[model samples]
Target: MKLLMTTAVSALVVLGSTAAMADIKLGASLSASGPAAFLGDPEAKTIEMMVDQINEAGGINGEKIDLVLYDDGGDPNKARTFATRLVEDDEVVAIIGGSTTGTTMSILSVAEDAEVPFISLAGAIQIIDPVRRWVFKTPHTDRMACEKIFSDMQQKGITKIGMISGTDGFGASMQAQCKDVAPKYAIEILADETYGPQDADMTPQLTKIRNTDGVQAILNPGFGQGPAIVTRNKAQLGIDLPLYESHGVASDGFIKLAGAAAAEGVRLPGTALLVAAILPDSDPQKPVVTAYKAAYEAKYGETVSTFGGYAHDAVDLMTNAMKTGGSDPAAIRDALEATQGYVGTTGIYSFSPEDHLGLDLSAFKMLEIRDGGWTLID
Candidate 1:
């Protein structure tokens, strides 16, 4: 992970490029500063770190990457402006963003019209449907997580469940998917409740579910402050039913924010970011994960979360496509569409015109917090 003196200086030079045509311009619009800032902060940091590493390793196709970042503040209007600026003013060949569904959804049309490639860190499946040829995604969709959660629950002989979702785009989409797929697994949802994104308490919602007759477990399809609050209140209110989180709550930060007593025994699907410490040796992505972890921890002094892993993979995938396609948007789109077995910080990404999401349900593992750390449960 040590960078040579020449490589480090060259990397600085590459990052300093201001002209549109000087190097490979990559634009990213994320919630860099907002209520959801933690989500995008890691993503931005990972991009910076990965760009430095790639540049240090002789750059991509001998043209260094010039990554441009914007803080959308989790606002749709701001995201649109940033996306437009990147495509029109900054003249970036492609865009990479790690905001939630609401912001990313607003920027999609602009990216499509500009005919620039966009790789998203958000997990809403609707973003890729109708499949914008210029758009790609690295995060596991909410529907995929719903499938995994319901399947895993069935395997564990849990059928009666209660639902709690945040009143946000990501939470809404996940809730709908859970409703649609719940019947498929013969799971009965006894009660459904909702809380606002910034709400500091979910005791009322949990109380309603706990009072319901047949609810045996709670399904929390929320993230950020919502999940943290729900976890805290669930323990304080003495809700003894098992708690299942959506894939959005994969970071160690969730455990820290939610508190050990509340976060304990919580089950959720494992993102590639969560398994760096326990990846199978035969996994093709082991080396890349190892290298990314070492360098990221060395620079930042902590573990990389799922958001960071997704952003890192986004750049790696786009860079690989650019290298293969030689900076042409159409060719890069085709190249990305044809990707297969792309080992990255996220899972091995393989995209096609028909299936933009490369990884399957098996890509996730079950995780629980035990002894103040993430432990794979299944």
Candidate 2:
């Protein structure tokens, strides 16, 4: 009886040890079914697909990644709730989601309090402006998008412009950033108009912009269907001025939503993923983006978007960090901050104590919609 008891005890101990070292918990909160679903759905899909691939090939350091994913439905409150659950209940070592700025902000305090490494997929300057200790992000900031557009406008001799933006978090943030930086690029905002996220028609606002004095072009800083509506409205109103959109709408869905004919001649700052096929072979991001695009399209049977690329980079960053940082949250944070020269689908990433986003204006490609496809412009 004593020998039997000893063997049972030994078996239990071994099982416990094996379970402890078998998997690393990673959490994600995305808006997979709401207005921002266009952004979140792809993000969630990419993370899941990447996790599966990693586990299939032998996850980081031989431990499988146990992904705990939740769809916040684009609600900030739900995002907070899911983030809390991830840190406290699931005990995830790191989090790799946030699909929107509002959702990212909602999860910030929760992750910070738990000291978990959080890598956001949202594109807001404020996400990393002050530089939170435990937070990092993959997408380029709204400010960067604004600057890129402004630079393009300056080159085109479009000094005076009108703005139509949404009142949502991303739209409002990009509008403010654009307004703040317009002067630096020798551009003037002659008119400004705002619309609600669900507003079916922006014709009234677009009319106002069209009638504004000295308005050489129109810039729309919004996402979802709002920008699409604006694009259609501009066409209906016979507004011939050059139309520029923010990076928030840098997805194929936008083109389809706005209709290819309406989206033609529209320009936006976007990542290389949008124009992967035409990118020069010498371009460093060509192979990386092509591989990711091919893998994603093959697995999902849908076109790739910049939003998915953000999640791809986020997963890449976290998994690479884990290789050196192990499962410890703080060590992972350090490894992430120390990351340098890592080529990704979006751009080359090099994180530091001062800047968590790790990319500059060069990461963006000014793309114009032509013949129902993206055309890279100088």
Candidate 3:
């Protein structure tokens, strides 16, 4: 955790390059040791690990990548400062970071002003929905997560559902998206509730949900400990309604935060990496997914989440763009837009100018907790 609070600047050189085209400078800003540490810690580790792997395999057309990384500590002000440093001082060609929605939004203007290609790891749709010319992201949009959850609810013939969300920027954004997209799937939002991110308990909200009529299921969309708190409260209240969580709680920390028994049978939208051990051998994503799982678990001694995989995809996508098109930021942006059929741990990515977050609804793996561990749902 020493690396989380400080900014470490180091060079990762692998091959020789001509004077005209020297090493490409890339940068990242992750929240390695703050409230969102669960998301940022693994992401920073993946980026560091992949850089070594890529450099060892002949370093992007014989030119090494000079990756300058910093930990924002989950602070928006720090994110803005680091974004500016990477572009103006370090003159990095591209940046990949801002681990949370709040932090990512803080740095958006800075990346745009410098015209450097930015691939954020934030979850909100507002990060790229307007389609900023120099910005792209790897995580599935909140809108997509909402649609994925609602579509599944419709299939089970469960139309009436209760909803709970945090008051934070990420939660509010996803809450609005869910409200707007629910009618399209013929799902009704029967009971609506909310709580703050730092709130310790959610029994009051669950009590409201328990008294609501025709509430066949419950949907809670928020990251951090919020969703886990809801799970604990629901179990304590003896509410038997099926609980659905957002992709936010896809990490093992959530399972630990809420006791295993309380999280049992709870369903959530996740990526293939969560069930990498059970994926079919013929699956194309299995190769990359399994490799990521093994490397991350071996190095960090912890389970890998889709949030970390998002950072992996961002690093590889930039590497591919530079290898094919060159180091120019514009060319990298164009190549990212042209990415098609790229097998990532999350899913197959296919980006276009109009669509920054490429994967479709199929990218999300429906998962349920059985016993005390993650169980893949067919």
In model 2, the runs with Cα more than 4 Å from the true position are 1-22
Q: Which candidate would rank higher by TM-score, 2 or 3?
A: 2
lDDT of 2 at 3: 98
Compose the digit string of candidate 3's lDDT tens values, residues 119-220.
999888888879898888899988888998888788889999999999876788889999999999999999999999999999999899889988999999
| Predicted candidate 2, C-alpha RMSD | 6.2
Candidate 2 residue lDDT tens string, 8-55: 989866753563433799999999999889889999999999999999
TM-score of every candidate relative to the true structure: 0.90, 0.91, 0.91
Instruction: Report how far residue 313 has shifted in candidate 1, in Å.
Output: 1.0
Clashing pairs in 1: none
Candidate 1, residues 1-378, lDDT tens digits: the string is 356888997785676454556478888998978876777888888888888888898888898888889999988899999899888878888899947888888889898999998888888888888788788899888888888888888988999999999987778889998998888899999999999998888898999999999787899998777998998999999989999998888888888899987898999987656777787787677788888888888999987877888888888889899889878777777888889989876677889888887877767778877766888766
**Alpha-carbon shift of residue 54 in model 2 (angstroms):** 0.5
Output the better candidate (1/2) by TM-score.
2
lDDT of each: 0.85, 0.92, 0.87
Clashing pairs in 3: none
Question: Which is the leading candidate under TM-score?
Answer: 2
Q: Candidate 1's C-alpha lDDT?
A: 0.85
Full-model lDDT, candidate 3: 0.87
Error of 3 at 355 (Å): 1.0
Model 3 spans > 4 angstroms off: 1-22
